[model samples]
Target chain A: MPAEHAGPDGPGTARGFVHHACLYGSDEEFLAMAVPFVHAGLAAGEPVLAATTPANIELLRAALGDDAHALDTAETAYFGRRPVERVSAFLRYHDRRARPGGRLRMIAEPVWSGRSARQTAEWKRMESGLNLLLAGLPLWMICPYDTRTVPPDVAEAACATHPARLDGERVTPCAAYRDPAHYTASVPPPDLPPPPSAALAPPTADLPAVRRFARARGAAAGLTGERLALAVLAVHEAADHLLTADGAHVTLSAWEEPGALVYDLWRPGPLGAPVPALAGYAPPGAARGGEDGLWLARRLSESLDVRSRDDGTRITLRVAGPGDAEAL
Target chain B: MAHTDGARHRGGTSGTGGTAGTVHVGDLRPGDHACALYASDEERASILRGFLLGGLDAKHKILYLAGADGPRGPGELLEQCRFTGPPEVPAGQLEVLGPAELSPRQGELDPAALLGSLRAAVDRSRSEGYRALRITGDLCTALCDGRDVSRLLRYEALLAAEFGSGEALAVCQCDTRRCDPAALDAFASAHPRSVEVDPLIRTAELVVVRTFDPPGLRIEGVVDTASHRHLRDALQSVASVRGDVRLEMSRVEFLDLAGLRLLMTFARARAARHCTVELAGVPPHLLHVITLIGWDRTPGLRLGAAHAC
Candidate 1:
């Protein structure tokens, strides 16, 4: 059980962070489950927070009328963006509401529209990570997937992340749910198009060199201002890790995609173990031992994808155009 | 640097005897690119005092450089050297330059750029009617801040050739109390003349250039995998007990997670004693990155621009 707070007090039990993935076909079904969960938390004077799509939030507010005002809520537009950012928001709410040995309820629905396959994979991994991050807190949470918007595969992955399934008035133990470690380790990294062979930079350990290279490529890609800066920062952070811990036989491959700067840093050395599932998933400054550098790297950029290879670890960082500073 | 012979410093001895002989600061001639290692700040100040006074007395144009991290706007010059300069210092015979002026390009640190700039400064000195241009600064701070060492060694060789033209002179200084041993050895051979001194701390993992006049620590080095315990232990024994602890970081090449945490750990510990830690000389853009990651608002920490000095 990894020698932490596992066994009786760990996730996947009645003790703490009780997560349930709700699958609903229509509005009536979503409300049938969510309205009661919120009402119960209010009756018991427990903190309850709901973050869903704007349309669903209005639907919930209309059905419960005066009672819905008691539940804290934010539209998913503000609630979820990047996986690391969304998780931080939830943790902040939990910290403010949590009491010793007490229980609270939560309703979370991630924004799924316009996500690339790579981003979808990251969201699923983060959903699974919640079990570990909140393992000791008595958190009763329901994560709903709307068939109207969520694809079947997305819903299936969401179900796999939660420990239970809530249908109608019954909450049954989920047969599909897997431990976060086992489940997250199965998710694959982003499958973006490869950079042109000519774009591969020869191995070097100079930070200034790396910065210059990233800036040139990012500028060529039409990345400017804060977006370009973040891409360079991401490249700097990831390369800094290799420079610190490895022999640093690292090559950088840069490419310009439409509206974004993508960089891949491949060092010709092994990272020993696989890149941990929880790496870079934690909030900044709350990172564990090995995940420290990646935490900042991931948060500062649009995405930081880590994949261990036979020769070395290849870190891909992407910074898209004109991003809002909403992650904080 | 090529593993060849040059005058090295033997304990308490100054001579032109063997490969390990030491030279006096006053003995430096025009066209001499000398490297010196000082065991303590007092010795460093004494060496600098002798070097600066000679230049000022000789009526040479003096170019002073702060460490790689800096008083970017100038002013922290002869004051810290604990020496007085000629009235010409105010009349434009003395000029202060930061690392930025060494290389014109923003991000890439090409040693050739530095050489070209130094050569140009020499030309400017001669055109201004000075006998020679005397250049002095903490050259080791660049290496500590992760300038390409092989390239820098090459730059030193080129600097020696440039100084050989009889228009300029430089004494590249390394504080042995703070320099990496490997870098120090490279400095000895990179120059035609070397002034090797014993080091106070033999296991210095990074270069920490401290200036009491400005009241700050100029951190320059590849502090990526630095020994945390070594850094913390040294700070505990050496950090000044009074005033705020201002860290100058313009010269730092890359600080990994552990190295950064060590700085914060030290800052927080200082904060516990009711002292605030201010980060000085950090570039605005780099400071923005620090703020982006939320380290800027860390408890007992404040962001500070480079001091005018």
Candidate 2:
């Protein structure tokens, strides 16, 4: 099968690699794309960095097999018995590795939900410290589960420093390609509750309710073992592409609507109407077909750079290109 | 938890209703309380017999003393009369109670605990049919916050309806060969009542030991070792009459000196005008000091009995 649209340069070629090498679609889809890059960097004697969650870390480790290097805060805390230091330390370690097969990987997990005050304070300090310390690093912040756990302040700070592509929560470094592994599903396990404090005193009657709430929250966070396993499987899918003979490239189908506009005061979407949807797309089952897809994508990109009519909501577009020493 | 008797002072959140009035040890009148500040053995003994024996009944009362250990000097007389150290007694027995042990920090007594103790003490005293309650310690004792003596005394006043007001006494020895002008000044300031004995001269009912002589003030022996009952009788006699006669006390000396000067000062100032002045139970030493100093000719003194040798 031709797989819907063949995309701009087709698949399986590394020509526009770095320019559009970002992975998008879903958390699973991004994992599918990231795994191979991780392996390729390890094999090519370059290091990889990932900032993700504990549940996602478990999935990544399982899919990467024993040869892949893995580090999540919880596992590191449990095994190393020392607090995880600087996020840059992982990259520094990879750079200094004596062996050729060693590659450094790092993930910053945001798991504070219903935690103690002391724990919350400690987590905030650690996150703030790490973000401030590694502000300039090229490490990919893989917020695979969700970004809500990371406080809004941290998200804004990180996004301000780096180029961020947010697609209904599937954020990445830039425009990304959707690999086949983007869509995977899993079944959840039965919920449980927290334990009693003093066993000798009395049996805890409300343990079941507490467990139920915990499970509900954990499920919403995409932290169940089953969901994590599915994400791990997606990583394998990404690894398959990275391990292919040449760079197993993928292409993103043009969004049938315009690129998502983050609420800037712009009007006239080509035919001149406020972008019908923020992602700037025609509703599904609309009359527009093949040309509509390309038109929408281009319009979205162009609208992103358009200057708005109002002052507060004004958005100006700038055009810059390769080999141009000067920028617009 | 402190209640105020004066309309000028606002009552505490948990204050009980109370009013202001002069408290007589035997009157047991409503809203009448005593403020007992004992600085000397005689004062302590006087307070012990007066309050404990239903002497101050017109007022709700409290006892204030210094040093909670086995009473020192005048305190020993009180110790003999069932006054307990802070440790032996329960908190209920004392009103506005604070001890050196209750607070670890200096000048910071717990107001809550102290107030609670006061209320409890008042309730206990009422149930026991006692006219007044007593809290033994200096106003300068450490309380909840670092409050000054004056403030703490006011606080005690506000909390308890009647508070005993007294002073700590300073002792001096004087004669012609070695006259202490400061000591004489202190004695003059005391303005002790002049009493002429055949040989001994009593001053403010206290025993006097003269170490020096002032030009006009006679020196004599005084009697300060009078029993609690005898002291009580002396105070009652003066208190029974309505007059402005003042009692001088600077020339007096005692084994316990706390509040002695303050008592004399209070008695003189509180007395009404145009009343008969009678000096009673002057310690023999104070009488001797008075004669030696030649103060018998001084005004405002009446001659009284000398102790039988």
Candidate 3:
């Protein structure tokens, strides 16, 4: 038996095999991490039950390819407001096909805030249903948000009666609750494309070509240069891996993992000759003293950025800033 | 037969009762001819004129008219009600003067008055050669200003049995909404025929199901355990004799304990024959109730969900 993740015991402190699952991290990461367990289980002649929303089910099915024994609970979506019955029905369907050595794995992606009070009752019912399903079966539960958003009763019940091994942290999980730094460090950053190869002559003032390139490749490809540039800076500041295409660039200052072009396209530079200051001042990650300097760089993707008095601090990357950001 | 001496010397104009001759009370049945009661002399005179000139039945020649304590011997009563011929062909001629009974005491309810009214109705039924008589509020009012259900049913049974079995059906109306709670309670209490619909489900034998936007039964909160037992007994009784008689549960909201017990009994009774008892319009709450009690698992009791309209 494993000392489960909770209380003072940290997530990394596990003696037994720890299964760490992430939701919507990336198609590649998900396939690399989650798919092997499913295939291995199925190949072993043990039934593997996987539940995702209707849209995600298709993606999963596409990924699963030939091993599609999955049945649709109405296109992989439960029909009504009652999550318990829907999950119960899904489990029932799975039970019919379950082999002797099979185990149940259920993943639910709630559209609402998992931490909100409004969904407490519904969550409790869902927990109860999950517990019911857990009877006579080994179940693994994954919810990709903070559990603190759930009502205290629901959290307590989940902690006490629920037999599931829960994943995902909306607020924070108990195992990582005491250590804020390790918890914060665990949040993986988004993958960005590498800079274009072979530096060419600076653009002319017209810059229409650069604009078109940015518009076509960067903006249209869902990466505006501004945000991408901001993210690149943030990634450099954090000293974490920046996965991209155009080959892996091991800068002295930053950690960069290449081959992200599969998902991102490069936007050409703006049509203007570089100014002296701009050309002279290199990025912190690509500067003279690189890796160690980047290592010394603070994590830019944090909740607080402002410094008191003379204290200098960096702000973490958030889609919204300050007053506009949604409450966690 | 025992009151012959008392009856003969009680009133004036006794020997000369009528020109058509007096009729003995013994000839009355549930369905006879017409028996009427007049509140005033003017009404009596007009009624007499209408009957005599308007063609009356010779059999229904006996008349009882009481106006301001005036003379009303059988002879004058006969003149007041001269027979012409039979009323129009196939006309329902049986009538009863249920409200004509007089008593010296005011506001005192007399059960005998109702009996007498029923007796008059029976006499009128006999005169008309009809075996069926309709008794409405007039007969009910004559029975001391309130419904006398037992006496009414007893009279009905007497009239029906004499003429032929199942010849009479008394249509008793009980509007719970308009009726006083005490009156309704009293009526419901005394009358075995009165049914109070199960509120959870709007099914009942004799209880009136009210129509609302969301239709359901408004039950009288009190549970009639005896009635339930009676219903069960009735169901069980029929189960053995007629296996084909379907126990209809159309208006029932929810089965009470007794109803459930009876249903189980019936199911067991018919289990040998493999006959099924069907239940319809069972509400979800009621179904839950039954399920909680484990009654739903009983064999031979098949119930279908109500169709949503």
Candidate 4:
């Protein structure tokens, strides 16, 4: 196992929002960096929450023995669920365990190699967005990446999202880390093929017909159960954004990718100003002021990519199906 | 078999029968499955008395399922309702039983068995030459006994499907004070018609008023993180049972993002079912806020004519 290294303040004295990335080439290397980080928190009496793969959790449990019982663990299966929900769950857990005037420690690996392309994109967005969401909170989070398992591009993206990286027992600042707001703002829309020519015409007076068209296409493409339901909601919320505006027109198309249901909505307008990172995390019932539809669409779908051009704004929403992992 | 309140009696009976028809306690028709939500013992007894008396006057066989609490027993309830005759128990016009008597097995609530028993009772009432079988019961005891609520809802749905338009009537009573809000909401949705004799009024924080007339829900008070779960459960219950829902939000003082999200989810689900959701009586400022969010243009959702903003 890796040994715990002393920060500037000495060993086990880190505070505030400390973001770290653990780059390891093997399970032993990952556990080496992870176990000591968790043990340091336990020694300092900070609440520790671990949200890693089930295999890693068992490894830590075996290493910690009875002490592992005290650590808060998240369901590993949840990483593949809606990114917003996972964020909400983490916030809730943090709120519950965080002591007044005390800091909380968390180890979260929200993205893995097997995740669908859409899931990976959403997880990356969530990683960047968390910088704003957890600002001013007394929390420290370390996201681990398995160099042997995670793709090179993903590992590179992690370096850009986290302020620091941990290699074995050595910790150093990541020169590549970009401010979350700037990084999120610069994320280009997903690259997808053009919609089939048979796409539904622009929605006008008949909004219900448009929703029905999307639903029929989604269902026929083998999107069933929760995936289908999520696709329908995402399409409706996005279409609603355009359908409600005067003279606004929207063209809808849906098709099945290898492991996802994709809907493309095109309207003849520029995507409005950049949506704030915190908008997605706003509590329900709080006055949204504006961006209500966009906020809702983002939260409902697995991934939402908006490409704005002088000619039009194209909104692409991807919902991961049961076969999402299989396609990877 | 004689009552002096001719006008009220006539009004009650006129609304009975048919899936689309409205039926209150005083106007219940056979084969109707009604849910009555009460906030107090007095309200519970009043609704029960009206329902039972209406059945007796119509010459139907009456069955009362009482909990241990009260109006203590059926005799007390009859006295409260001002029945002029000696106890009609020996005369066989009415029967009072405990909730367990209807259970197919001890300590368990089986929907299929319960339905079978109800069907048997209906048949027995017809063979005994009664006009119809009218049953009323307090579900608090069963729920307290750990009866599965989903099973109970399935039973209610089964009852509605089997006898909703026929000559037998069942009124399941739930005391709001004893039941959890989520359970109460579920019970309300399971039945075809629900009546709240005692309106649910809480300290100004939040109050969800479920109305049967026109079949809609009125939300008054703040819809924030503190109360969004309650709002979601309440709206979901109504949405699960009915296609067209009228939401009266004019009285709503404040609605946060969470509330708006719940509303949007509800509207989307209803739209998928091809149902219309009408938002009525929205204050102008709130209307402005809703329009700002572009929710007014959501599919299957309509802003009522009363919305000025």
Candidate 5:
């Protein structure tokens, strides 16, 4: 499970593109693996970029001395805005920096110790997506995961996303790495509990009433300030779609669970099969446009889950509180 | 027809309601008419009590026209509403009468006479130190008695016009179980505002309808993975129309990843066509979502002010 062959060895002359996860216990261990990679890339005359914590960047800068200026360093927080945005930025950087017919080198530690659960989930997806995103590009990406800092689940996810691992410079293929498409499809967020509040059934013509209902309930549930406004707005968006449709009726409910405020909108009738536009998964040619609402919802909320049955479709929106800071 | 001046307030008081979801009957200005369709006796009584109590609080002249064969008379129904203050009926400020009293002649209907009676009531209320005349009538008796639907509709329209003059407010009650859908629609269309006592039933799948005038599509229902393609197709079709496309997203309840992508794709496509895509009634959360994904920065995309309601 820790390591196992990714593919056949290429010709000695052609540059190889390796996606390896570096699992380390201490700062010294991270340096031990990272410095050599940077040295090797420099020796190979390839452009090198390091996207990690500022402290780590500083450490590497000091260690590399004059050679540090030769490598590009970007704060990982810049890329942490959202997984898709980060990938787009990386692709742009790679395209601009890569030398034609030459190799590109990148060391990315995108996930940190204190990310929200939603953030972690997106990061994992980003990792899996990179397999396809960087397939033909002459890039070798080293995704570093601190075994001491990241949760066991995230470590496991890293193993599944990368096709190889570097433990103290011993690069070996990862048997656990599943195909990107398969991995992305298999890992879904857990189902949330039903909203505790009773559903507010408002007629299509009475959308204002439903909005008022949601705002009041959201306020009563202690969602104040921007959080309260966001919760109410989220509920309004969901209720608006249901009430305005040609449906008979729709019910909206909101409740707070431990560290998150949740809203559930239930509308009767089948929604057919899952549509690609709403999947939020980056499709082929996705760089152009699509899944705007899904992306917005996911980015705004801590988590969003949609369940559709033959009789009805229920959408649950959850916003993480300060207390629910365990990585997504 | 004599009240053409009242048309100025036609759309003004059409959708106004009190805060906290309460229908403050007294706060309704003249030319304001509301429909209260009830499914059961309890709901009817609750609505009537709220309207009467609000009128009483505002010192308006209250008139309750009860059905002829109902078990409880207007007086009994008023008592059941549990008024907080002393009874105002005997002092002449509140009047509870049967539909027969309002009829031009015994067991007969006269639309013109009824209009004259309503006008007379308004004049008397203003002159007798009342703020306004608030009327609640149980139209079920008239409809059940085989009264002409067109005549009833004409009377309702005249009443609306009369109220439009800013002299009175009317709450016409119809028994949903007794009235057919067509008859109900006819009555509802005559009034500016309508309220149904029964809870709304939930529907499956989101419904998208293309609107004319400003040219937009109104979406309702959950826009998740299962329904995003339909939404994309709808938007693509709408995009084929020239000029700007307005997306009325206020009614959409749940927009998942796929839904957002479709919106972005449509917006981008429209931008490519040199057409702007405007979004109206976007909830605060969606605005936040839009901001988060930086979709608000998409070219040729304009987001209208987020409506609180």
Candidate 6:
């Protein structure tokens, strides 16, 4: 099924807020979309950057020749590791290159290989989210996807996330571009296997006990040093937030999932209000969304998914292993 | 766990209610001899300022007995006290007596002789037309050097009994960093009251201590939802303080996002007024979160080594 709305080209694909999905099957095709994008920005004195895989950056550099000197490039693997921080990195890069009424042109490529199906979708959500987040800036961004590297459905996400598509000849409006908020709301939370009965801790509002239990679980999951600290802090924040909202006890279930530690916090009663689509993505000084602790938890952990189900809210927080940039 | 006062080296929350069953130094009246188990000279100074300032403000006689083993002598520490309110202490109303004058400055401490001197001072203050006599002894060793543990306990008990129901109030200062746990506990039990600084925040999970000199707060333990408002109130209490407001957090176990957000809010607010909310010894993990969200980038917020020592 389509991840978002699909239709014909419209004003959404126009020059203003120029965001496009650039699908390429080969190196030559990637350059065909990237070279012109970089050159056009350089010609107009706009800051041009390429945050993609090295091979593609090499291809674009080879195609652009001397003009590539003015371009900035970052490995997508590192640059887009954590979604919230990725936004900050991008905004910082753009702000640094900003000019008076000028613009920035960036070639962003989401790291697709080695990502779980759910993670791939998260990347797509970040892509769609960028359209709204960076709309006011005179920024032109193209999200390139190697159709050969990703599954058919994963490649199709680009169409739903971007306003325009450049699969071959020219940049045409993406027929499947849904609104960012609409797409984010429709996306499903990552799958978390039910914990072994022994892994579940009894529900309690005793914060100190909960803290010790969660810290022990995180350490047991092989998280250490800063990763362990981040996990513990994120858990404390989430549990504390729930306690504050409902003034109730919270159940915690934690287990190791491959290279990550997954924690599920179940609190009774419906969490007030729908989780805001842009929650936790707001920067420090920006207008905030949702609870501050939860917002920070989303940034601290690998991912935070708040789901309203089972007559309550289950907030899942994940923290990835060290040096696993892709997982981060 | 154990409501152990003085030996609070471990991270624990501070409540507005002061330490369990303790009285604020400002609340101490004549006939009250309170034992204060302090962790640092910094902490002792906080209690001392409140103690002496109250006496000075009331035009009462102030007798400061400095510890012989303390880093500084009575005369010098008195010069550095900087009571904050009164421009200068009345020369005749204030006296600096060290352990040398207390128990003969030799042999074992004589609890009887010390009581006689304290009694005489109380009588002298009354004769001088002073409203009250305030006696604060830094017994961290200055006065405790030659005395055995039992003798020290006897001296403490006698001091409390002799000063009780009189025009004199005694604040016995025991340095937790230097005093033994058994002795510290005994010292605390001797007096009818123990002194606290009117805790900015004291909860089961977190404690916030206001500091002078650098002028900020010393936060300990976890900051969760239950204590979030206390943390906010504590920050606001020091918001109007000029210069850098140092937040000492080495003992803090954890702080929630709301607590962190409140810090950034205050940090930003202070920035506009040309003041800084400097964070010293912020845990490495919390520092990462602050920097990760760019809260550390706030103009008036300096993280790490701001006043490291």
Judged by lDDT, which candidate is best? 6
Candidate 3 per-residue C-alpha lDDT over B115-144 given as tens digits, one digit per residue, 9 for 90 to 100: 455556657665666544433222322222
What are the per-model DockQ values? Answer: 0.09, 0.00, 0.00, 0.04, 0.10, 0.29
Off by over 4 Å in 4: A1-16, A26-32, A75-82, A116-118, A168-170, A185-189, A205-210, A216-230, A241-249, A256-260, A275-296, A320-328, B1-20, B23-309
* lDDT by residue for model 5 (A223-322), tens: 5554655555555545544444454455666677788767676776664333221244332244633343344444456666655546776667776654
On TM-score, the candidate that comes out on top is 6
- Which should have the higher DockQ, number 4 or number 6? 6
Q: How big is the positional error of residue A98 in model 3, measured in Å on the Cα after superposition?
A: 6.4
lDDT of 6 by residue, A32-116 (tens): 7777777767877778889999888888888898998988999888884767777777888876787776767788887788987
Error of 6 at B76 (Å): 21
Q: How badly does each model clash, as a count of residue pairs?
A: 5, 106, 38, 11, 43, 14
lDDT of 5 by residue, B74-168 (tens): 46766656555535553677776666666747765566777787778778888998988888777544753453488778778788767877668
Displacement of residue A227 (Cα, Å) in model 1 is: 5.1
Per-residue lDDT of model 4, residues A1-328, tens digit only: 3334544222324445667788878878877777777777777788988888888888888887766988888755674266666666666667679887777778887656677675676677677777776665677778888777888878898888887777655777778888886786666546565556435555453444555676677677766543454455567666665555556777777777766677787776654442343344432333433555555666666677776567676777777765666433
Tell me the tens digit of each residue's lDDT in model 4 across B201-289: 33335666565534567766556445678887788657765558888775565454447667877877789999988788765544544
Model 2: per-residue lDDT, tens digit, A224-281?
Answer: 3322222222222221211221322221111111211111111212322212111112
lDDT of each: 0.68, 0.31, 0.34, 0.65, 0.65, 0.72
For each candidate, give the TM-score of chain B.
0.54, 0.33, 0.30, 0.53, 0.53, 0.62
User: Each model's TM-score?
Assistant: 0.61, 0.20, 0.31, 0.51, 0.46, 0.71
Q: Tell me each candidate's RMSD, in Å, in order.
A: 16.0, 34.6, 30.6, 16.7, 18.0, 8.9
Off by over 4 Å in 2: A1-328, B1-24, B27-30, B37-39, B55-77, B80-107, B123-147, B160-309
For residue A204, give model 6's deviation from the true position in Å: 5.0
Instruction: Please give the lDDT score for candidate 3.
Output: 0.34
Interface RMSD for all numbered candidates:
10.7, 45.6, 43.1, 16.9, 13.3, 6.9
lDDT, residue B237, model 1:
46
